[model samples]
Target chain A: MTKPAFIAVDWGTSSFRLWLIGEDGNILAERRSGEGMTTAAQAGFANILQAHLDAISAPLDLPVIVCGMAGARQGWVEAGYIDTPTSLAAILTGAVVVPGQSRDVRILPGLAQRAKDAPDVMRGEETQLLGAIAADAKGEQIVCMPGTHSKWVRVVDGRVTGFSTFMTGELFDVITKHSILSHAVAGAADMPADTTAFEAALKAAFEKPQLVTNLMFTARSGQLLHGTTAAGAQALISGTLIGAEIAGALSSAGQGAAITLVASGRLQTLYEEAFRSLSLPYQTIDADAAVRRGLSAAAEAIWLKNESKS
Target chain B: MTKPAFIAVDWGTSSFRLWLIGEDGNILAERRSGEGMTTAAQAGFANILQAHLDAISAPLDLPVIVCGMAGARQGWVEAGYIDTPTSLAAILTGAVVVPGQSRDVRILPGLAQRAKDAPDVMRGEETQLLGAIAADAKGEQIVCMPGTHSKWVRVVDGRVTGFSTFMTGELFDVITKHSILSHAVAGAADMPADTTAFEAALKAAFEKPQLVTNLMFTARSGQLLHGTTAAGAQALISGTLIGAEIAGALSSAGQGAAITLVASGRLQTLYEEAFRSLSLPYQTIDADAAVRRGLSAAAEAIWLKNESKS
Candidate 1:
């Protein structure tokens, strides 16, 4: 018998993506849409999955696996988290065979949080961590994902341990785009990549973080009295946010540790430079591809379960 | 001659408001518009003033005094700030008579900050201090204005002694409205007043100021696990912010002295209660009223200067 195709899904708050992969983990066809968890919550998750299924001509009996927020309380079915110090085997989201669909459907549970200092609640990333673990055949590793809220997870012997979340991206946006520093820059943000300005700002912020407020005055002060360009001010503020993030993250994570950063966006260059400046050994992983690979890994696990049941 | 009608303008970065004052300082007419300094900059100060003049049928020549950001360097003109420990008379923006117009124009200089811990800046509020001081007419006082940024100032001998700014209101808004608190709460925060929730949060924050991050968890956990409503969680966050403000301002300013709060606006009720609970004696000042009077004071200063010059 020809190997049956395995279906995979990686969904988030704003977007939904799906993939059909062969036994060798090769994606035959892929599709994405705006029907994410947020909209799905409004229309019901069952309907969202149907829309995706209608797009594929494959048999409904094919084994399917899902990751991301789809297993959140608001998702199709709550995939209960297995908690920290847990492995993939232990972090199972009980399989739910969607009624009327011949194929088995299993959704990965999200990780819920009640951390001491952080404000965010996450669900899908743990499954991705599971995928990361599955990606590597051996050895302990730490997965660092940078974005609006940066997350770092430690994996030892296939068991997920402690994790930390930082509001680095959001704070950077606020300080440069919304807060008082708006006056210090000549023009609005999204100006362009300014290496010189970025470096100047980073050095100042790292040297004396308190000067942030003081530096804000220079935006208007220079334009008003000393004549500094708005673009220069923008760079200054951006630099400060990045610099402060380095200063803050370094203090917590400490120095001289290897880090594997999962970043695949406009911020790739900036974060790469930041890691280099800190003199830390690190590697960058494609975020989109990782999510896709994670979905496939989850699907593979579901296939094993189905084989066992039969 | 009969006393001339007066105009008091309190213009800032994001808003412009003015009051038409009768000879006796009664508010005959008041108007506010979105054309704050930040937006009105393109029209030039003279054009903005003309727009206000067009709003009123009364003579354009009625003595006009301006305060707040309108007097900053990028403002119509840098009504150079009066140094600390200086009188209103000492820091007057030299009398400028509007050419081709039959009236007097006196710009009140905003206070320039020079704290070792903060950079120097101030505007229209300095004139309000002049009016606030004039209203008090007794001795010394402290003014606390809470918003995205909270300001605490010490007024002595009719001049600002020193002041500091705290990112409380804006920070609170960011955390509750834009940050993680948004998810924990059923909806966005515009948390109504709940005295018990407010007081409990106040007490907790006051007792353990450094546990701010630890305290944030309650915004979500209290609701999911402990039965606190999202609004209640939001209120607790607000309480913590104000509590942090009180703690920060006190420590920054140092204690062992009596304080009279220039209390008004949204801060009046909670701060009054906060002061009472802590046994700090303070008298409330009407903020909106103070601005009108401040405009009048600036006008009065301008008139006196002309008379002395003649």
Candidate 2:
């Protein structure tokens, strides 16, 4: 029987996913829930972890490795940050042990760019970056991890030079739900996305990224004047935001730096369409897989390799 | 007592300001209320107007000239729009009279740029432009009316070549109120404005308008990493939005076009500070007086001159 060697968890701001990994480094059992850092702060992170461990009837002494906001200042424990420009491999060794835990539990540190002019911080994405890029990767790489706060990281010779966080997804959610444009996109949730409108807006905003806000207004005015459908309005908003994001992300990038998009599902489709519309080339990496690989690396470095040596 | 020739009303989305104008082109009496288009739509636009009119003990035969959202399709009456590439004076002739009213009531038409690529519409600001710029004025002028939906009009030889509406103010409102940044800027309402942060962010966003969204995230990150205050976070958001707006507004303007800023109170102060910080020369116009002058123009065209001729 292949026994579970360790536990791996990705505990983000609003989501939680765990996997019991065997000695072979494959996922043997899994648990996913809404008990992320936000919820866990109130529900008790240890109790939640124990419940999940008991659900799979894992060994009592099995070690666990966690990443994401669970290590935030307000989360279960403060894992702190590893300042850039640092190697991706540095994060694996920066994992902070969860004190007073029944089992050996560790949470990985985040990445922070403390430049006075362009300060930035990211928790789980640092781990994802570690898994997405090889430790010995050479050349310039522009890695885009799109989500609520989309992160665009500039890496050279496997070192994180800097990164920018675009409030793309969070802005979209607020604008569509709370702004006057809310009226323009009210009934577009169930309808198929208007890709034509999306492509046009994406191209326009990419070329003139400064007019992004004005372009957003067209979602409402276009509906009022040209009778644009709700789906078209929604698509226009999404495309405009994502387009400006891409332009900004690449504004300071090295010429011909390989664009690596780390995303999955709807964001993947949208970003890929945006890049294709703008004729910008990019390679795709599944975000879920990348984060898992990152956690696994930390797990192996912290437990598996140590056990084998012992 | 000066005879009240007509009433000039700026019936906007959330505010109502009416000036009883005498035949001498002076305000005889004034009334202000929160019963704007939104509240008036539910309470009945006619009743709200009548109450204000009755409060002043005005004659039953007094006529009314209204501008703003009251002329919107969802307002008092469907006043329709005068398409762009037309003279500024064209709005005066496009007023639609409300039928079945006790007194004569006219709603001025808004300006609409029907171009497919950059469709836009403005309801009340056309009248403001009418008052802000002379009919026979020559050369190029860039008129910026900063409000909920900031309007930037490009006028060449008194003709509105085109305009764009930047969702700067509304985006700021929604982002600060409903987005994750809300936590960053909490309790900022009473705090004094952080001019230092505002100027820094404004300059940054202006220089790299494409990075507006990314710049916005720095407000939160700055707070977390550098212990920036709530006031600073709020200022950063405001400055970024306004800076991006200014960059986009001037993207296609003629070289050295005169910048005319029509705003009042807080908005006027903020925009003036922004222009000064950017070292952009601009002339100021009082928004309240401009709208009044605009509505008075419509009144003279629609009723006063016609009645005098009769």
Candidate 3:
């Protein structure tokens, strides 16, 4: 029986995530904090890490692997991203080793893809794709990870081929909060299970794709004339946003790409319903389950990689 | 002949404007400054007003009639707006008089519709619209005034029937600065003459009208796939923004209510082309001309109202 040898971190804009795992891929403990990259930007990285690290009374020598914004320009270490159409294997295999004062910490570099056909940059998803392939181990798999920036990652033979990112969450915030659509949305309400608006909007999206801008006036106009409330307006906005997301994801991956959507909560149902309606074959995986699983797997791989050298 | 008994001020978010007119409606002098409401917010209203007045060597004893945010709760004085379908006869007739030290200052109220129906509000436009109506005096007409918050004013029989405001400028800023669409947009390029992209986007807007949200994703997808650079992307963003503005204006005014577009400089061609393509009849009045006429008209109304009292 081996003690936990390493921790994996998924540091995002709003939250800091930690996963502890043994050499034999098993989760030992986990921690989280509001001290994410954004907060850490204000509170300095060293203090945040020290405060968060206090959660574990272990040897400070434990090797740790960090992902996400923790590797970007403002993150803990600036591990530059590699460009698009990159593989997880390439990322994990090529991840820059970030040395911490008290421990051996490795921060992964995000990919920056600029090609004739595709131009995009991605970070953090590469490690997860590596872990997902390590777990799924099937043939070519397209992983659709949804968040502020939704990524459609292509993995072939445990290697990341390429991926595209849509600034879905950011756009959702802008359109809903600032655009004419704000009049349409209220505070978050439970999405209708059937997602009637989502389906209609998606259908509308594919049919008359240009309505994106024109339909905006209706958010306010409907209320002005037709007496549409803000809540109903919000639904229409959500539907429109999801519709755009679906159209972009479908076009990026193209038809026949079996999409395994790693999602949960409200977005899960919306994406599930939207993908199902598109006649696209997809499997809905609990995002949280995959998150820890992916984290632990990366930890185990890193531990082994270091162990072999030792 | 009443030498201009007062100066009328139309202060907005980005620009400060003032006009001095004789009792006979002759434009005596006019002044312009970048120190508008938002900028003025930092400088303290008294300083902004005094500085501008100081620049023109305007008489402190001359009373000033002001419209727009300068009268909001955050402004120099909270001159409350009158409800509409209410007329300028009512607003002008119902103007609130603020007694200042040396000179009497009055800030005219903007028009507020059901905050729910359109959540639209306007300030300077009420005075400007009155001027447009004063210029024509044919009584009731629709004045389409375009700015960050585009207004379509209902002038019924020499009085303001009602008006609605749309957040076009703010929407343009958010889309270009924050939204995924920003990837495609140029940094504040002047609207090209008969900008093909702008025209096409406007057509796309009115074409489906309902699927507007779906269309936004293409701003990113287009750039990603077809090498749509920032300028072309910006054109699309502008197209979408203006298209939405046009849609909002059209919807508020309903189909074909005679409209006189109050604008000048760069906005003239865009508005003229948009209205023409939509088959919505409109005539353009120079922006400065309208502002001058509006200031003169407001002054005349104030003088008349005061004389009636005296």
Candidate 4:
């Protein structure tokens, strides 16, 4: 068995994932939990990390590299942000070292676009970008990372030019839970997704992105007038949001820009289906793999190569 | 004072407004309360309506005309709907008489567009439309009624063509109260609105309606990057929603269609500003007066004129 060399952690707002990398550059062990920054902020970030390290029986002196909300102001440590238009490699140099730790710990900084009109910031996803694209890649590339707050980033010749965050997933959650659409989506979770309703809504919203809110109202109106099922309503809401997001994201892209979709599981299936339905071409990248590779790059740049040189 | 002729009630989801109309068509007495459909459903609709009637010293035999949510399926009575592509007078004839009442009480029916692609329904707003536009008015007319659920109706040659309901106001409310943007607008209510931010957001959204959710994220990113105030964030959210709504509403409007804005109070000011910012020509009408006039028309059609004729 390959000996564990370092730890890679993606500590988000509500989720935590840890991977122990061996000397041979392979995942020796992995752990996932709900002990993200929010939970760890209350439970103690050090204690949580220590417990996971203890469970994995990792080397006491092993260096740990972390990314995501753990570096946010309210998280474990403020790793700060690297302003655009910056090369993806700038993220490696912006890692903030944890103070007074027995084992070396570093957290990657986020990316901030300071444009007055389109001000935007993203944490964790920057690392995913690092792994998803090659440093020497050519042409304009649009990377879509779908999640609670879906991000659409524009990269020109390996440097991130700009990006926009669409509140798709979070909006879906709130609209179906707190808004009038809640009644329309009740009993939807227990049912299978209605693909036909989803694709139709996706096409409609993509064509008339301005009518997003009106399209959302159709979730209830359709149920009332067309007798659409709860599952259909849920699919409509999801598709409308995603469809509008895709339209907005692609609006600023350069003509013939390649699309790289970084997602996994349900989100993967949904976005791939949306791309097909809309006839938009895109390449897929495993989100977990991308983030892990990003952490690996940061790890080697910060510690591994430096240790060998010393 | 002229003798009281009839009672007009506009019972909405969360508000109740009643006006005692005299024989001369002037308001003799008025009562406003929070006993709208939701509250009335729990506290007894008939009892609530009778209490308001008693407060105004209304005669027992005096007839009543109702509009708004009170005519919904879950309200006082199911007043049903007048399908679209019909004369505005159809709404007047579709009034449903409430049974088991000593006094003659009728609830005006709503308007429903049964288009499979864009099914929509409007209760009180239809009555507002009845008063805002003349039945025999020629050409195309677009009515903008901004509220919790903003409604936009397209009318032509005295017939109601189609309408759409945008969940703009409701989306703003939920996004600000329940989503991440909630933190961006924490203390906005106590502060004056930021018109600069509002106008900028309005134009941005109007130009790129598809980028709405992405623009919404600027409410937070602006604060983080530019130190934008809570008021500014709130204004941005409002402007984005309203701007997108206007863009969507106008997308389907016919060329040379006159815009009739039916709104009052804060909504009136906001929408008026939105229209002016976009340089969109619109004539304003008092929403209260419009709904009242509509209720009066319904009363005259159902009982007042009929009583004299009999």
Q: What is the alpha-carbon interface RMSD for each candidate?
A: 5.6, 0.4, 6.8, 0.5
Q: Which window of 10 residues has the lowest lDDT sum in candidate 3 chain A?
A: A207-216
Over A1-310, each residue of candidate 4 has an lDDT whose tens digit, in order, gives: 7877889999999999999998777998999999988899999999999999999899999999999999998999999999999999999999999998999999999999998889999999999999999999998899999999999999999999999999999999999999989999999999999999999999999999999999999998888778999999999999999999999989976537878999999999999999999888899999999999999989988878756521
lDDT, model 2, position A265: 97
Query: For residues A1-310, could you state the per-residue lDDT of candidate 2 as single tens digits?
Result: 6777889999999999999988877889999999998899999999999999999998999999999999999998899999999999899878999999989999999999999999999999998998899989988899999999999999999999999999999999999999999999989998999999999988888899999999999999999899999999999999999989988888967547878999999999999988888888899999988998898888888877757621
How much does candidate 1 score in TM-score?
0.72
Q: Give model 2's TM-score versus the native structure.
A: 0.98
For model 4, the stretches where C-alpha displacement exceeds 4 angstroms are A306-310, B307-310
Can you write out model 1's per-residue Cα lDDT over B126-209, one digit (the tens) per residue? 665666666434456667765555567776666667776666666666666666566766552465666677777776656544
Better of 3 and 4 by DockQ: 4
* Model 1: fraction of native contacts: 0.02
Give fnat for candidates 1, 2 and onward, in order: 0.02, 0.89, 0.11, 0.94
For residues A249-274, what per-residue lDDT tens digits would candidate 1 score against the true structure?
Answer: 45444554567777777677777776
DockQ per candidate, 2 decimals: 0.15, 0.92, 0.11, 0.92
Candidate 4 per-residue lDDT, tens place, B1-310, comes to 5888899999999999999998888999999998889999999989999999988789999999999999998898999989998888889898988999999999998988899999998999989998898888998899999999999999888788999999998999999999999999999999998999999999999999999999999999999889999999999999999999989888977536878999999999999998899888899999999999888888887776657621
Instruction: Provide the overall lDDT of each model, using Cα atoms, as 2-decimal numbers.
Output: 0.63, 0.92, 0.66, 0.92
Residue-level error in angstroms, candidate 4, position B150:
0.6
- Say which candidate scores most in lDDT: 4
Error of 4 at B78 (Å): 1.1
Which of the CAPRI classes, incorrect, acceptable, medium or high, describes model 3? Answer: incorrect
Candidate 2 residue pairs that clash: none
